[model samples]
Target: MRRIATAVAAALALGLLLPWAMPATAASAPPAAAAFRQEVPRTILALVDLREEDTIRLSRIHTMVELPLNHLGLSVVYWNVADGLPDLSRYPGLRGVVTWFAGEPFADAAAYIDWVGRAMDRGVRFAVLGQPGVRLERGGRPVPLALANRFFARFGLRDDDGFSDLTYRSKPALADGTIGFERTLSGVLPGYPLFRKTDARVSSHLVMRRADDPASDSHLVVTGPAGGLAAEGYDRYFDAEYNRRQWIVDPFAFFRNAFATDDLPKPDVTTLSGRRIYFSHIDGDGWRNVTEVTPHAAKRVLSADMVRIAAIEPFPDLPVTVAPIVGDLDPTWNGTPQSVEAAKTLFALPQVEPASHTWTHPFQWIFFKDYSRQKEAPFLDRDGTYRPTKSDDHAAETAGEVSDIGRYAVPRAYLQQPFDLDQEIGGALDYFTRLAPAGKRAVLVQWSGDTSPFEDALAAVRKTGGVNMNGGDARFDADFPSITGLPPVGLPVGTERQIYAAGSNENTYTDLWTNRFYGYRNLVNTMRHAGAPIRLKPFNVYYHMYSGQKAASLNALVSVLTAARATELAPVAASIYARIAEGFYTARFEPLEGGRRWRVRDRGALNTLRFDRASATAVDFTRSTGVLGQRHSQGSLYVALDPAVAEPVVALAEIDRADRDPPAPVPYLVEGRWAFSALAGEGTGEGAGFRVAATGYGEGAMVWRVPRPGPWTITAERDGAVLWTGSATADDDGRLALTVPLSGIDPLILRLRPILRPSGGAAG
Candidate 1:
């Protein structure tokens, strides 16, 4: 409970400007500000460079951002600034601008210079990603840094100007032997609208000797270590010829270490090394003298100031966040009957949200670059399917790659096909569309290898209502990138291994063991990644098969998820959570006098407006359809938006002031159902009964919500027949403890009544 409150407090702080938001009207207010009230935008512009930096992060900026953009509110129209700048005049309701600059913006210094000048003239907000710009020398002027200085000036930021501050979040403490490094990380400062936690997970990373330009108004949403001990360009610098050196030691090394990825069976005999005993005997606590397993890494308890690791187990009291990405299940990949059944059953649960990874999970971009020159388009197996083939006659082959004769290796030719829009997107969705249990279908498309598609491919996917997600938050440099801004940086062969999202967890799960930590602390990456005047961009984080691929990855993910679920940040499905994100990000708190202001926009979305006083709230309307629902969220009044509508709706001073603010919604207890609390007096009154709307919930499911701490009872009935009744005690802060099945609770007005006692005794 203390942790949840801390998280909420952080989120409610809103933005960098603090208690009061800075006037959207900048020093250079545009002529459009004349119609300021009417012209405030319901949209934001996200200009990205579509490129891949590392083999692990993937390329294609848009692939990973759909969920965040949609869930946050505000429609975004993407543009490649690489060609210079777009005509921003069309974005009348444009609130701010963000860019994943990378190395491109610097290369085209002249074009970006023009764009930055225009942005300043128009009083726009800008955010930046990656390093400000690379240092180019061996010539006349240090001009790249100068241009970066000016570009950031538009957002009230100044580069470090060759001055830098050094800070560390975690130290590389060696373990006694090989438990691995201590597997722990920083926590978050909950409640911040953007960052899930307040811990300087990213901010610490952004700390540089002389890289970032620090601005007072620019708050670091995330901060973490400068880099790991073995970080490239730091402890381990690879020269240009390093690749050639690997070839010499590679062949012999492969045969030397036989079982590196796995372990050999524990030897029955133990040699007395004098220091320790190894008998292959497992301790009662599973702490084997040889092999002991611990609980998930996130929950590992620590004592003596982090000297020891305690094995702990923690379960999800909140809804499970669904990754939805499932692969290796296509029939061609040995999808057996039992495997198919298990897949279906696992996804059928109300909690699991399914996603598509194409029928054959092919490595997208790398394979394309390696073999696109092949006349066959390598692995072009009918565009969507893979068939056995061997066109290469190369003698250098591994047993696995070759046929029965050797089977050691096959010729390195076309291994897998590139992005097949039709087979992968449309056909791949077929299983989900058919298998989805009534009312639900896969909404996200998980990419294979985080390969982003071209405009044509993206259009095809949008036509099917699927959104792409797989690329890292900012590493979009691999897929022949479709850069948005003016300058283009980084050659195709460039590699950036810095973990940009480590502010919340300074150490990777591996780092917890290895004691090597470094990161890119900027989330949204700018004036705190956008305009310093506004709150920071939503601190977004995610992991991939590489962040996991090994068993250690699971520990990393679980630890992170455990932290997220504990806070109010734990949201519903990606779709709904996306709406909430939209509500938060697109929220425009335009302050009027006397605590009167235009709350968050309702442009095809919903928003919650908290007030110090519930005194006679009146609302006006613009393009909004109608108020969908209302309740109390964490002690504040929340208005649910009907995303289906786009017209503006105003909540004037005439809105009702009621005490029936339910603490939270229990939409998770029963999927597809709307559950909220209302003050109950009798059975028939102005404030009576918890309205359980027939939202088409699933079977055998029940949902609920309570406003305040007290004993509560809910009786579900239909027609005149009482179907179900349940009771539970709420905490002081209104914690609904319900225990009942959906025998007949479909859609009914469940009037929650206080038990009446005969004499004054207790009644539950």
Candidate 2:
């Protein structure tokens, strides 16, 4: 045994080291061996329409195929086989056909049925698309009864007890022991392929029992109940797209049943190759136009298969031109009753900038063919007489028309012409120049198409002001080339042509990639042509709401708006304006500093000069007079004396201490420990009334003291001379206080002589 093992190891080493040295058969082993073995099935094909019906079916398929078990190693081929016959030859190893036959008008039922039958007989599995009860017919003829019965039996549907009940006659048996009448032959056939790995007995296929009847030999398949096709305990299929009006038997269960019965063998796994094929037929339409059924079916297909599905839409190649102002009325007037309400709705959208394309787009002369007869031409005189033909006369008339539209007719931020015709463009400019306010010139001009002359004309318009060229050259095939002979620096490149393509039939919403790419490209192109003076940005996007009524279009708009908001380039001022209009008050202004020189070190320091009606002098400060035994006014306490004064008295002004009352008075001493004095100048005699000047005084002044609160007299005297005297009291702080009268005292001079003081030493 050792010797034999040594020899085998030596042979293996030789084979690895020198493959060519091995026998000829061994040298070609890899390819020859693979060729002899079967390939595992890894992909399947699904054919659907490009309309809403396909969307519904695809949605349903997506749901089923999305399951982990089904998706593990499978792929799907989604094809819009609207042309009837698919190029099956392209898919060399195509295993089976999953088809929705309801929507198409079949030319010959017998021929098509025969073709399908032959395909099935040739070992190609047929997975009928859609749920049970979905009817289909060729040339308006129902599929043969025998063919239908055979298909039904494959799905475990058979009449028992020879009952003639029509309801049960052609019904498929369900897992819940109930039966439902058949609507189409495929209604009784499996809608999905069964893998070899999936159990045949315990699966839904065996669980659904068929009655013993003459029709038992028929071949049919039904999907499981929990599957999207059937609702709980209900034999009917559930239509996800509609308002649940349609129901049919489960197609998944039927397929599993057929596989288990051995009538349809499991696809040869060894022959399967994991290659996916995608087919789509996209045509421009709104969301509502596509039947709700299409998305439903799509969901199911996507769920059942692990494949990439693409839907291509044939969007219209709209010629680039300034978007026409659909309707316009006088500024003082409201919208016309006949105008679409959508215009108003559009206006309400974010940054829905309005522009005039004349009162009705086409030049007035062209629009009202009989402008001269109707006396509507600008050249017509007030009395309806035609003016003599003259160059300046024509200019004046054109100006009047422009004035009517600019001043009275349209309130839009900009104006547009119907076309870039020389007369129209040049006339619009002249008219606007005449009608525009002395300082305000028309800032923008609009025109249509991508003609070379149009590009040149744009340069001329820009030299005078700004111009917006409509997206006329926006063809899928047209490569947007750079424009030349304009300004030394050009406008943003992409802004040149604003491509307005119709939305996809399946998705009515915005196309993020298309819009972003196209919009950005135009802006970049414009910038490249015109340079920075021209503020280039994608200004508008237009779509028809009635196109397909697709919710996707609305959804796309929302998404685009959201994305625009996220973009830094989006106008910030507009957003702020919107917020302000919503009544969301917020102060973004910083306080203005008047350049005054004042160091406010403390809260009390601020009170000295910061005077308004709320100023309280007594509560803000303490006071001291020039001498003792003299009457002083409480108002004098806040007086700002010259710096020449002995102590340069600052008077507490009204001490504001937190522990005291809200406007607490500052303490002062008068009769006992502290004293205040008033002195008459040299000229003034002791016998006459004496006076001392004090500068600051106000209505809020009051002399306050601590201890016992009582009324007291304050005499203003100097050198035996008396100026004035007043009675006051010490309420909370211990000090004699007086209310100084401001009447007749422009520059008050008074003597403060405290006649009495509180018992607890003069308040300090």
Clashes of 1: 90
Give me the runs in candidate 2 sitting further than 4 Å from their true place: 1-35, 49-72, 79-82, 103-105, 129-136, 147-764
Candidate 2 lDDT over residue span 325-417, tens digit each: 322222222223222232333222222222223222332322222222333434334553323222421211121122232222321211322
Compose the digit string of candidate 1's lDDT tens values, residues 325-353.
22233344333343344345534544444
After superposition, the stretches of candidate 1 with alpha carbons farther than 4 Å from their true spots are: 1-36, 42-82, 96-121, 125-333, 347-350, 365-420, 436-440, 473-571, 574-690, 694-713, 717-722, 726-749, 753-764
Number of the top lDDT candidate: 1
The lowest-lDDT stretch of 10 consecutive residues in candidate 2 is: 270-279
lDDT of the structure predicted as candidate 1: 0.31
Assess the local accuracy of residue 403 in candidate 2 as a C-alpha lDDT between 0 and 100.
Answer: 24
The C-alpha RMSD in Å for every predicted model, in order, reads: 18.5, 36.1
What total of clashing residue pairs does each candidate reach?
Answer: 90, 140
